[model samples]
Target: MRKIACSLLLAGTLVFGMANSDVEASTHTVKNGESLWNISKSSKVSITNLKKWNNLTSDSLYPNQILQTSAKKTNSASNGISAKKGTFKTKSNVNVRSAAGTTNKVVAKVKKGTTLTVSQQKKLGNDVWFHVKVNKTSGWILSSLLTSANKSTSKSSTASQNVVDQAMKLRFIPYLFGGTTKNGFDCSGFVQYAFKQSGKKISRTTLSQFAQSKKVTSPKPGDLVFFKNTYRKGISHVGIYIGNNKFVHAGGKQSQVTSLSNSYWKSKFDSFKRL
Candidate 1:
């Protein structure tokens, strides 16, 4: 069984390497005071590598269990080059850590309470920028702007408000793909535009948005649930499944409200969740 990491007790602290994946599940049960870094270090592995092997981002470990891990990347770096590491508190339920240098293309998703690593930064005359790496790739970001992990402040989201308002105002609007205006909209686009109206920063992709929140067995009024079986495995369409087995979504030619208990939606439904 895998042992727990003691370093995790340090209020969102982690010490891991870029590539050291020859990990074995902990043999003993994890006790109260163990940090993930301590366990990895004692086992001669790095935390990053441990995460890579086990696919873990948020920290908290248990005792007496084998961990799922993968082999370390051959080209991964290890030698400590002069680098600066900072933290970014999650403003939303799910935060994206993109390649250090891309206008688009998310590298990985960092959940709340996880410490992100930073390296050689690009400063603007004594100012910090977003020059850090998530899983791979480097990019520019305001270093000073990236809040410390210790900060407890949260980024506000009005997704629920906007969603409800849009549904009410455009109760008759049709659904279309790539349509942002009130004219027509696609499954994901409808949700995006509605949330935008409500003042929430959301992605364009449905699956990406779905990954932003944890799933729920039952949905709330403004919850954005997804459906599939018509295109992909996880989900292909989206809607705001309101209370009483009903939902509002942009589909066919107009944004329409339907029932979650309907045969078509029920069969195609994947899951409902928050963001």
Candidate 2:
């Protein structure tokens, strides 16, 4: 009887340990400006798995929400590979960096429509970087710059192009404080006027426009690009993105086109939005 009791106790302890191990999983605390897509990229987990694990029915996320990044498994079956392999095409001229972040060296520059084989993905900072092979070069590119080869540009592209065309017509116009006309314009005023000309009416001020627009991850032409702490603190400037890492904005002495890669703008870059 003593031997039987000892064996039963050992079996119970083993079962409890196994159950505890099965329940253990990893979690992430959501941050401001983060989305389910962002978390999926960073954690190397699929959005489907994240939703399933956390019992989320929608993609909506709020700051400081604790989410499970992995699921509990009772069996020895593998969760499968985290990285995806696929054929992708560049949406615009893009830089392939030596590493996963923009701070890394540029290994190559590929033009728009370049075909690439993405073998893996890594999340560095707030952006997802894809490890891609083009020609003989292998480097990292921002996922935002590449789209699935099977997918086509959406219908919104045509509407965005119209806005870009309208904005470009006013290029080289002189900049003026609080100006909103063809005579001269401020940054927000320029964007507002361009959208109005494109048949889309948007808010007139940088703050209000930013507040009213929807945040976007993959910004296209005519999307509103915002910057913080330019002449003043907190979302002080705005521009209309014209794609290829460039935007048309009212800045300096005149309205002009500028590159987002410009050190000053890059440092102050906030987020892209769509009206």
Candidate 3:
């Protein structure tokens, strides 16, 4: 597997928390600030290769849009990149290293729900290594720590759990009215941020998000449960469901996990939507 440029790691603390597992194709959900060239630089896949894989005539991308990063598998790695191919979900929070071994420098820390595209599989003594791509970043992860991405039940469950795990990592980040970064977050901003970290993209504002999603009678964990008239007349707040009738959101003074059954939220409950 070719090495993706590690220089970006020095530029900032890269946070990868998205989880998607598709056996048919290796795909990436474009984030808020990503561009085609940036994706090329990170995945180490040439712009030409990316376009060919996704069948793009122009360099246009929007948040929540899923783009195929590698071609659909046809009995082998058809992308001309890896030898052995499959979509793999990280079994745990893992470090993506610059090389296949621990002696290599750490490039980024990928969260549990993070999905990887395995291009090459290598066995070095007791440690089996897989050269993989996590969103825009490509690196090596241990093979034993991955499971095939073909199980929808396991995939969704793993994804939701990973989303919760990643959200909790930012505990106590102060609430910022319009903030969407790790530094701070508003209600909707926190929801977007959490999903983005988990490798999924959603609309930025509560109203847009509420309008964009499909309403569901019952919410699954990780579904967006919005609230109306929190500070305004209509839908104004959103949070990520975390099972047990609980969700995590940026509320009051900071980001936190709270109960959906809580009197305040329960009274303001608007609807649930699956994205």
Candidate 4:
């Protein structure tokens, strides 16, 4: 009887341990403005482990995507100096290779100002390589050619105001159908240029810009003001709001400052948004 009781107790303990282990390997829902780097840091897991557990090929994350945070009974290691995960930008045009070495085949040539989502890194002697994803393509780039995205986004408020300031300075620039230069600009092109100048990267068209941004109820200076049904149905035009019901956009034959309260504009006004 005594032997049977001992066996039962051991079985119960093992079952309880297994249940606890299952509980340890939990899931997290991705949120807006979150990265695998930040999630790993918050979850006390290595970025490598996070990717492996979640089966993520790239560092990109979207709002509400569920991810596994850990594996049962596995210790979450620290992301050491050899590996990092974050957003980076190309300093200049650079080749993304198949592997960490110069001998690897070049998979893509990324242009300057292109944004990269880095998921992993490897240090080889004096050289370090980052595993980066640009759009849907994944490859490796030399660390020296990459700059941290934080350098631009660290002062987000200032950058936002700078976008408006830059737009305000272009009041009289001529408008062209698809112009993206200082000499001429279309509505979306003007917006893209102003944001780029202020160290923010936005999409090239009004539709893409609207899709990528988050809607806001109370807009501040530098928030995006959208309009619909100006030329076509759905979201058509975009501008940078500069408070007091005013916004700056490429309109008519030139870039101009206009009022959201204006009858034509007010009728077409859509919701304000932020990137």
Measured against the true structure, the TM-scores of the candidates, in listed sequence, are: 0.42, 0.45, 0.45, 0.45
- Say what the RMSD of model 2 is: 19.1
The candidates, ranked best first by lDDT, are 4, 2, 3, 1
- Which candidate, 1 or 2, has the higher lDDT? 2
lDDT of 2 by residue, 111-212 (tens): 999999987776666778887888877778989999887454454677799999999999999999999999999999999999999898888999999999
Residue 272 of model 4, lDDT score: 99
Residue range with the least summed lDDT across 10 consecutive positions in model 4 = 73-82
Candidate with the greatest lDDT versus the true structure: 4
For model 1, the superposed segments whose C-alpha errors exceed 4 Å read 1-162
lDDT-better candidate, 2 vs 4: 4
lDDT of 4 by residue, 1-275 (tens): 99999999999999999887666547677899999889888888899988776545778777776677867422334322244789999999999875577886676899998999988787767888898888877778999999999778777768789999999988899999888999899999999999998888889999999999999999988899999999999999999999898999998899999988799999999889998
Please give, for residues 78-188, the per-residue lDDT of candidate 3 as tens digits. Answer: 433336788888889999875567876676798887778887765666787888887676667878888888586677888888788878777799999889998889888
In candidate 1, what are the lDDT values of residues 1-275, reduced to their tens digit? Answer: 12344445432342233122223333323456666777676666677876654434555555432333335322225211124665565444433322223343444455554455565453345554454556543334445335666343222224464567666676677666677777778778788877777767788888888888779886667888788876667678887766688888887678888887888888998888887
Off by over 4 Å in 3: 1-150
The count of backbone overlaps in candidate 4 is 0
> How much is the lDDT of residue 156 in candidate 1?
25
**What is every candidate's alpha-carbon RMSD to the true fold?**
18.9, 19.1, 22.4, 15.3
Native RMSD of candidate 3 (Å): 22.4
